[model samples]
Structure formats: C-alpha cells, structure tokens
Target chain A: MIFGLVFWLLVIYFVARGFSSRRRRGYRWLQRELPSWEQKNIINAEQGDAILSLYKLKRIEPRRKMDMVKVLTLIGAIFVGVGVIFFVASNWQRIPAPIKTILIMSVTIFTLYMGYLFSYQKEGFVYLGKSLLLLASLFWGGTIALIGQIYNIPTSQNWFIMLLWAFPIVPIAIFFDNAYVHILASALFLIWNFLYTVNNSVANYYYPIIIFLFMLPTARKLLISRRINIIGLLVASLYCCFYKYEWLSLLVSVGLLIYYLIQREEFVYLYASSLSFIFWTITFFTVRKIHPNFYFFIPIEIILYLTYKDKIRENLIMCLVGLLVWLNLSIYSFCLAFGYKFNVINFIVMQSLAGMVIYIIGIISKNREYVFSEIYKVFGYLVTFVCTYLLSFQAMIELRAQVGLNNVYLAVCSFLIGIMALLVTNEARKGYFENKAVRLELFALASALLVNLILLASPSVLTCTLAANAVLVIFAIINIFLGVELKMSSIFTAGTVIFALFIITRYIDVGWKLKEKSLFFIVGGLIISSLGIFLEKQRRKVIERMKQNE
Target chain B: MNKKIIFFFIAVLWVIVVAAMIISKQSILRKGKAVLLETLPVDPRDLLRGDYVILRYKISTLDLDQVKSEKPYYKTGEVIYVRLEPRDKFWEATAVEVKRSADSGIYIRGKVGYCYRKELGVIYGIESYFVPEGEGREIERNIRREKSSVNVEAVVDSKGNALIKKVYIDKNS
Candidate 1:
C-alpha cells in the first residue's frame, strides 16, 4: 500500500510539473529566436518588439509560483489520506468486522466532507481539496478490498474487481479536470479491458461502449496529451479483441498508420515508428501459419504506392515509408519464392539492418528536409540496440529456430540500405564527411551490416558470440562519444551501463578460481568508482560547455 | 453540477453499496438453511487481498450415471441447477437440471465448468474463502489431514444463490 501510494506521488509530481506554463515557454522561445529572426530578415525590429510587448502584457511568469503551491498541497493531502488508509490496514484483523466497516465508512465520508468543505467553501486550497476528493474514491477501493477480504469474496473473477475499480472514479476525475487522476482512471480501464478479454471469449462490443461513453468525451473535455494517451489504451483494447488474429491486427495497424499519415502529415514519423512495433511483434512471434498469396500484396502495395508516390521523392520520411510498405510486400514474396521460415537470428539481423538504414536516412536528411529527426533516430536506436544486445548472447546465436513465418524482410531492406549508402557516399564526395555526426552514423551503419554478415555465416557459437560482444562494446564506445559530442546524459548513461554489463557478462560464466574472482571484483569495483568520478567530471564539463554556447 | 452535491452523491453512493452488500449477505446468513458438506482446500494468494483457500466440495462433481444432467452436456458458463438433499451429515447432489424443476428443492445454481465423459464439473461461486495473510496454507494442510476432515458451512437462498458462511477445519488434535 505504501509503495503504491509512493508511486502515485511520483506520478503526481510529474503531473504537477506540467502545470508550469507552456505559454511561458513559447514566450521564452520567441525571446531567444527574435535576434536570429532579425539577423535573417524574417521579421522587422518593430514587429519583434510588438510581439515581446504582447507577451509582457499577458503576464505569465507569476504562475510558476502557483505551480509550486499546487504541487506541495496536492502532495501533502495525498500523504494524509494514504496515511489514514495505511493505519486502517495495519489494525484491520484486530478490529471486529462491524467496527471495521464503520471505521472504513467514516473515514471515507469524512475525507469527502473535508474535501467538499475545502474545495467549495474555502479558497486557495483547491489543489489540496481536489486531491482529497480523489483520495476519497481511493479509500473506497480500500474499503472494497477490506470487506472482500473479510467476507471471503471471490476475485478469481478479476474482471469484476477491474470493473469496480475503474468505472467509479472516472466521472470524478473528468469533473475535476485532473489529468493525473484521469490518467489513472484510463489505466484502470485498460486493465479492465485486458481482464475482461482474458476472462470472456467474446470481446462483446465492450471497448466501443467505453470509448463512446467516457473516453472520447473526456479527451474532448480535457483536451491534453494525457487525454490522448487514453486513445493509445484503445489500441491495447483493440489488440486484445483481435489477439487471436495477428494478421487482422497487423492490417488494422497498417490501416491506422495510413489514416494518421494522411490526416497529420507532420507526425508521419511518430505514427509510423510506433505502429511499426505491431509489425515487429506479429512478424517475430506469430505461430499462426499464413500461406503466401502474391495477389494479397498487390492492392495493398499499390494503394500505399499511389498514396505516397508524389511525396516519396521530395520527402525523406516518405521515401523510407514507401520502402517500409515495400519491405512488407517483399517479405511475403520472399516467403513464396524460397519457403524461408522466420528465425530468431534472422529477425534480429533484419531489424538491426533496417534500423541502421532508417537512422542513416535520418542523418542524411538532418537539416536538408523538414523532419522530426529525433523520433526517427529514436526508433532506430530502440530497434538497433535491442537487437544487437540480444545477439550478444551465445544461446541466441546458436539456437536454430524452425518456426511458422510468412515474411523475410531482410532481403529488401539490404537493397534500400545500399541505395541510401550510395546517397551518403555522394554527399561525402561534396565534403559532407567533415560532419562528425554523419561519420558516426556511417560507422553505426557499417557495424550493423558487419554484425548481420557475421551471423549469416554459419560459424562456431563462440565466434559469433565473441564478435557480437565486440561489436556491442564498440557501439557502446561510439554511443559514449556521441553522447559527449551531443551533450545527452541518457545516451551517456546507456553507454556506460552497457559496457559495465558487458564486463559483468564476460566474467560471469568463465571458470575462475574463487580467489581470482574475488580479486577481480575488488579491482573492478575500484575501477568502476574511478570511472564514475571521471564521467561525472566530464559530464559537468559538457554541461558547462552547453551553457557557455547558449 | 455543484461540487458539494457531487461529493455528497459519491460518498452516499459508496456507503449505500457497502451497506447493500452487507445487508444482502446478512439476510442470506440469517434466513437461508445452513448446509454442511465435506470439501478439499487449495491455498492461493491474491496480490491485493492476500491469501485465500479454494474449497472443492464433494458435491461439486456429479456422476451422470447416478443423477443424470437433463442435457447431454452443458457448455462452459452455462447455468445449471444442482438439487441437494440431506445424506448423513452433509448435503449431496441429487440431480443437475438445465432449469430448476418443481421437485428441485434446496438447490443451488452453478456455472458449468466441464460437463463431459460421464462427469460434470460445477462451480458454485462459494468455492473461495479469503483468509488472513499466511493463514490459508494452515487451513489447507488441515483439510489434507487424514485423521480429520474440513467442511464448508454454506447458506443457500431460496432462488439457488449460495455463500460460504465458514470453513470448519475439524482436525483431530
């Protein structure tokens, strides 16, 4: 209970942090960019001054102080309410059932009354008041658990508990316009969806009911990114409904991708990258035997091609997206031609290959095109690192997988990678190689290809494993250097952690004398401590450099 | 939608639900007949509410050869009526009917679990007994003891609804 309470408190911290003014950020950005705009002759001096004055007149800075107040009060009230709950739980069995019921009811009612008094009757404590109101519902859930425990109520029907937990508090969350509370409600609703889907064979028109009744209306009323996350939960529900049909699920995802791409062209990379995960899962883990039909890919590929053909040459993102559709179709064709079933090593190699290609394309289009480069690069990093990290294991390298597969995506992606590499080489001829970022991107791409080639050749398990580990170590170093160059702490952390794990994994399985092992542990501990200190100093230097540049 | 009114409604609604659940269960305990039956216990833990014992009653499985089901086989989740009559100190299943016939007295409704191979498995919904944390294993061990027996005392309503009132572990010490 305390852990759950603490977890929610942290969530509330992040939620409360969002109260810091985005409008202020917009002004700050304008303030910073005005001089650059002036230098570029995009806006005249008078217009810039007018814009500055307009922001100044609106008076946004004072809200920062209010955000602090809101966070503190919300945190404090939640602590008190959850404290009451913990107190009740500790003494639950000691008290008689009737007294326990009274105690639970009284506490719940009192919190509601106090919350009402503070929110409606008192002023300047609305944050605390609403928090208490939210906790009032939370207390009711505890009451349910307690009473159910006392009465021996069956929870084998997890759907019942999910329903009771989810449905009650959503209206309160919506009414209060509390995004954190609304998010929690949405999470519970998704849990209900999973439990219900698992318990009942039929999905039975359920999510559409919630989606129509509560989800969309709340999204409209609140109109925030948090509300948008509820839509993501709808995807999970739909996934649950169509879990048995991976083919139908993939088609649904592809349809969603096309719809979103057409509707919001700017967010094409994000929608594509996120929805691409469904392809990865369906392609990798599917047991359902799919017979390849050449005609199946024709309409789908033609539709995608006709839709994106005009944009493909002009837009780098669309260029890759066009290839993505081709990749899928080619997988089907390859399945037909060679009768190649999917393997674990093949999937990893292919995903890594494609990821590097996407990343190289992102680097190529960095400033030349209007692109959301971070999202593209993030998808690349996620697939590449995760795949490469898995390939490091000896078991994965040696495991001969004979599974049901209807796709071989690697063959087509290699062709795309070759063309993209040619484009990079062409750019290099014009002295684009001088850019360190492009050099790093090329290095990563080469490393991915080398790893894929090594895995493709049937070598001894030790050779593949060692080579994979070596490549991972080199990439880790590259990541560290890139992090240092770009001043990104997360990438730096990932690099150091991966290297540490690499060292740990090497020492883990090898047969060593106990004394030698102890010696290594002590020596390694000292080295890690020194490295941490060095990295901290370097990180500080990077931060200072960034600030100086700013 | 005044804030205070909503708060009042929410608070009142919670209290009413709690009260209603308690009142209904209390009515069943008070008015319904108490039937004792031998059962086996299996201990399992729930994440939130802690440990519980699943009671499998002797009456849970019905032999089709003895008192046949009305239907050839019942599908999962299909409601089936199980008529109980006193046999020694415990109640035994007399017949399982798709619908409660006129002679189906002192019966409880169960959802069909598996009804095939001349055997029918019925789930009475009174199978779960939520114990205090770490205590279910003790009761389960007692139920497994050869010298003694574990029995479930249940209160069955007129409309065939049943709730386990208590799990009596009569382990001879």
Candidate 2:
C-alpha cells in the first residue's frame, strides 16, 4: 500500500509539472539565437542544423532563466498541497481510513521527490528546489498528521511531533547544500523550542547550542554568502531573548556583528552562543510580547564603534534596517502592554523620520553601488511615500487632541536614525560620495532633524496635514521628473499611482461611508491597474528612444 | 550512484517509520485494558488534519486537595498519574500523585498544563478524537444539549499510556 501510494504520488507530481509547463526551453533559445547567428555568419546553416539536431535528438537544452513556468509550478504546488491538507483535515467518511493515510503518504513522498528533483537533479532549478524542499517538510508534517488521524493518535500541536518533522529535514538541508532548506529547518527547530517551552521550561540554555550546531555545518560548507551566514547568526541569537534573558539576546546580536567583523569566512567562534540568542528572541515573541531590554542601545553603541573602525557599511545598513523593523514592533507591543498613549500623528512623524533615514542610507548605498543598493532605495521611497500619504489625510481635525510625544521609544528610535545621518555626513566629508546624491542625503537628514524638533514641539494636526499634502504633491512631481531623466517608467507610474491614491484616499475618507469603503477599494484597484498599463507603454517608449539613439 | 542510494535509503526509512508507527499503535490496542471515561467534547477544524472533537474529561482538572504532591502547585509539563476507580460505568479519578504506583491496576498518565493556584489542568495524549468533516458541528450540538452524555472508551497500557478507542453519546440525554 505504501509503495503504491508513493508511486502514484510521484506520477501525479511529474504529470502536474509536465502538463503545466512546456519543456521547450532549449528550442526557444535556439529559435531566438540560431537565425541571428546564421545572419551574422557566426555559424553556418549546416552547423546550425547540427545544433538543432543535437537538441532534438538528446532532448536537452540550455538552462532557463527566471520564467513563468517555474512560477506556475511553485504556485501550483502550494495550491495542490494546501488543497490536499484541507481535504485530509476534513476527515471525510467517504474515503476509507487506509486510503486517507495513503493519500497523505503519497503527497509527502511526491513533494519530497519534487524537492529533490529541484535541488539535486542534474540541471535542476536549485533556488526553486530548496523552496520545494521546505514545502516538502511541511507535507511531511501533514503526513504525520494523517497517520495520527488514521490511528486516532493524538498529534495536534504536539511539540514532539514538530521535533520529528524538524530532525529528518536537517540532514536533507545539509546534504542538498541549500540555505533556504537550512532556514526552514532552523525556523522549525526554533518553533519547536517555543512550543515545548510553552508546554514546560524543560529546555535549558543548551537549546540555543543545539540550534547553533545546525548552523555550524552550513557555515562550514561555505556554499551560502557571508551575509546570509551573518543573518543566520543574528537569527540564532534570537534565543536568549526568548527565555527572558533579554540582555543576553541583545549582547549576542551585537556580538555576532562584531564576530563577523573579525572572523574569517566559514570559521565560527560563538556557535553555541548564537543559537542561544535568536531562539530566545523569536521564541519569546512567538509565546509572548517581549519588552526590549534597556540593553538594546548598548549594542547600537558597539555597532557605531565597529562602523567607525571597520567601515562595515553594507552589513551595517542591513543590520540597521533589521533592527529598525524589530525594534519598531517590540516598542509598539511594549507601549500597548504597558498602557502608554499611542498617537497616530506621532507615529506618522516617526515613520517620516524613519523614511528619511532609509532614503539617506539608500542614497549612500547607491553611491557605493552596494549589492542591495536598489532594494534599499526602493524601500526608502516606499516608506517615505506611505508615510507621506498617511499624513495627507484632511480629517486631521478630529486627531488634533492627542498625547504630545511622551514616547521614549520614539526618542530612542530617532537617536538611532540620527546616527545614520551622522554616518552619511562623515562618509561625505571623506569624499566617498557623489555631489548630487550627497546633496539629497543631506536634505533628507536636515528634513529628518527638522521634523524631530516639530515632533518634539507637538505641532497642530491641521498644519502638519496641509504640509504633508503639499509635500506629497511635490514629491510625486519630483519622482515623475526623475523617472523621465533616468528613463525609468516604474518610478513615473509609481508617482502617478501615488498622486491618484492621494486624491482617491481623501474622497474615500469623506465621500464613502464606512459601509461603502469596499467600493472605494475596488475603484482604487482599477485605477492602479490602468496606471500599470500606462507604465508599460511609457517604458516601451523610453526603450525605443534609447534604441534609436544607439 | 550515491544520490540514488540516499534516495532509496530515505524511501525505505519512511516505509519503516510508517510501518513501525502502525505496529506500535496496533500493539497497544490489542494488549491494553479498555476503560470508559465520562467526558465532554469541543470542536475545532485542524487545517492539516480534519475536524475533530477535543475531549476534556471530568478528570482533566484536579483540585489541589485531591492530589498528593510535595508542593501546592505543579509546573507545566510535569508528569502526573491519576488512579482511576470505575464508578457507574465510567472510571473516575480516585487519587492523583506525582509518583506512579507500580502496584496500581488502573491509572492514566498526563502532563500538567498551566496549573493555577486552586486547580491543576492535565493533558492526556488522548484528548483529541478525529471526527468526520461536517459531523463535528452536530456532535458539538449534541454535547451542548446533553453535557453529561459524552463518554469515551480508552485503552490503557501497563505503562499507564492511554489511547482513545471510541466515543459514545447518550441516546436519551
């Protein structure tokens, strides 16, 4: 029964992959290139024919780049897996118990086969394959569940069951040499730790050490990037915070950053310690809202010293962004839990300053041509636009009565952001930046500094709202002009979409009653869709213009 | 060749695991003593493993006075044994203790859930019973109508481990 189940599952999986995507990749590559090569006399017609024959006879092709087929396959896998899980969960009486168990086993085998095919198959989609392996891990858990269902074994939310699911995949991740699979294994192991501890404090500091051992092998393998390894270290450091050793989690986080600054590639020192911190913080948040210990800033100070000494700009910037996100959530949760007043206006002001900090960092990263330069710049623009748009609401009159920024969290956040601006200025003085970008960076810094004062003074909601709407219009216009200058239509379209959303949001706010807001959303979605069409046309125009110039 | 060997090994390993799981569960059911427990069931649909009734037994919560523990409060996940005495066709908790009595004939083991000052909640492995989809709501409705109607027959091994064998709802309730 098990063998048959496994066989049918494999057949179903391959059939799904085969039917959805045509394996005409090589043919397409040949078609695109062969004619051009022939016209250029790069290859004779006879040679071309020979290559075509080779492709046809061997059923082999050049590897594909990113395409719709892989995406479709990924999406299809998710849908099918979820559908099967839901079906299994239903415990349908129509399907006999044995059949239900068999079906689950089949899916488990099928997903694992797909994962292996993707990750380890000769000429496999390694990136997609690792993701598939993670999905397979999930299916394996489902397989356990179905078995539990079949035999009336109690398995729901059993922490031991999660450990069972996690352990088997750890070897797979290491053997397959896939970072994403390692991440999945790490996350699952961490989740198990949380779930188990919630059951009882049976696990000790050794829990994090176990987690570090998982990473130790991956780090030694040296297949993944140094940056990912660093991130992994940071993630592992999450453990200490989880077990109420908040100071330890924070120290480990800084310690990892410092360790990476000093350590050589693929060599690790604090393997046991890294595991302790990440598991604690992530697991802590999973079980209960964690208060950021006062020790948070101590790490920032250490990071500043390291930044000054090492010029670790890329990791530092990414680390700052990660900390910003983590700290933002933790502080908000702290405020809510402690009954501190949460003012939306203050939040908006804080976000804008945060945006300025991100934008300035983006500018600096772009000047240096860092690996994730575009991403930082894009995120910077996104956060700035989102905050600005939020602030543009005309209904600020109702929000005028508010707690004046008594938020120590906001102050601490600003201080962290101010450090970023200072770093940018220090770099600019060293002549490490271009004039245009530096100017923009300085403007963002000044704006951020000016707002901190306004935020501190508790400006009236009406004045802030008017200023925000004007700034929004100005920023949108600037984005459109920048797009034209840079010959990038995505930004131009974004500018158009933002301006439209600004108008539409206010109309939605005033004209639409609470009941009719869904209509507003529908219309807003259509507008964005139309703007996308506009973007495609404008993008083509720019391309054509560049081609003509060439 | 190495990859092929690993694949075959993993495949065989899973088969063994599934087969082993079945054999172990079957062994417990075949050799264990069957005891009936009066219970109530609540329903929740598991995303991956269909709709099921969560059985909260009358014995799930024990008063501090009833249990003979060294301390007043028991920590979560601490193991405890409940000695059962058959009362009116269903076994009821007669005594609770931290140490299992080797001399006892009928008892069940459970882990301590978040124990409050006045009450200690325990979780036996046999808490959830998977029911057919769309049938769980009806079962829940029946349970609501007759609170004392639900009774489950469970199999207990020599080691004090228990598995829920069957659930019975009183027809005249």
| Chain B TM-score for all candidates, comma-separated | 0.92, 0.90
Over A1-550, each residue of candidate 1 has an lDDT whose tens digit, in order, gives 1232232234323322432245446667777778778779998888877887664422223223457777776777667656655554343477788898888789878977876787779988787777877777667666766666666667656566656766766666766565656766676676666666665554434554564457545654344423344354436524532454444344434544444455343233223323343332333233333433333344345434543442322223333333443354446445646777545566557667777766765666674663446445655565577678878876677672223222355555567568767877777777757878668757876776787777766456777787788888888788788877777767777677777767655655342435677787786677667767776777677667766776
Interface RMSD of each: 2.7, 2.6
Which candidate achieves the best DockQ against the true structure?
Answer: 2
Query: Candidate 1: which stretches are off by over 4 Å?
Result: A1-114, A122-132, A142-151, A158-162, A165-171, A176-341, A363-550, B3-8, B15-34, B42-53, B59-85, B94-107, B112-122, B130-148, B169-171
Give all candidate RMSDs, comma-separated. Answer: 9.2, 12.0
Pairs that collide, model 1: none
Give each prediction's DockQ, rounded to 2 decimals: 0.39, 0.49
On residues B14-132, what C-alpha lDDT tens digit does candidate 1 reach at each position?
Answer: 77778877887788888888898888878887765677778788888888889856777778778888888999988999888887887637888888777788888888878778766
A1-550 per-residue lDDT for model 2 (tens digits):
1232232234324433442244355457666788679889999978888887664423234567877766675676566656766766777788777776777777777767777776677475765776676667667667776777766666445566667666776666676665555666666666666666555555334444554445544645453433354454454354344445554455545455445455523123333223333344444454556455334455455544544354332333334443454455566667768777766666666656666666666777777775446545655555556666656665653463455564755676568576766877788787877565345445544554454444456557666655666666666666566656566666666667666666667666665665777777788678767866775676577657755665
Q: What lDDT tens digits, residue by residue, belong to model 2 across residues B6-53? A: 655655666677777777887778888899987878888765577788
Top candidate by TM-score = 1
Interface RMSD of 1: 2.7
Best by lDDT: 1
Q: What is the TM-score of chain A alone in each candidate?
A: 0.54, 0.50
| Model 2 CAPRI rating | acceptable
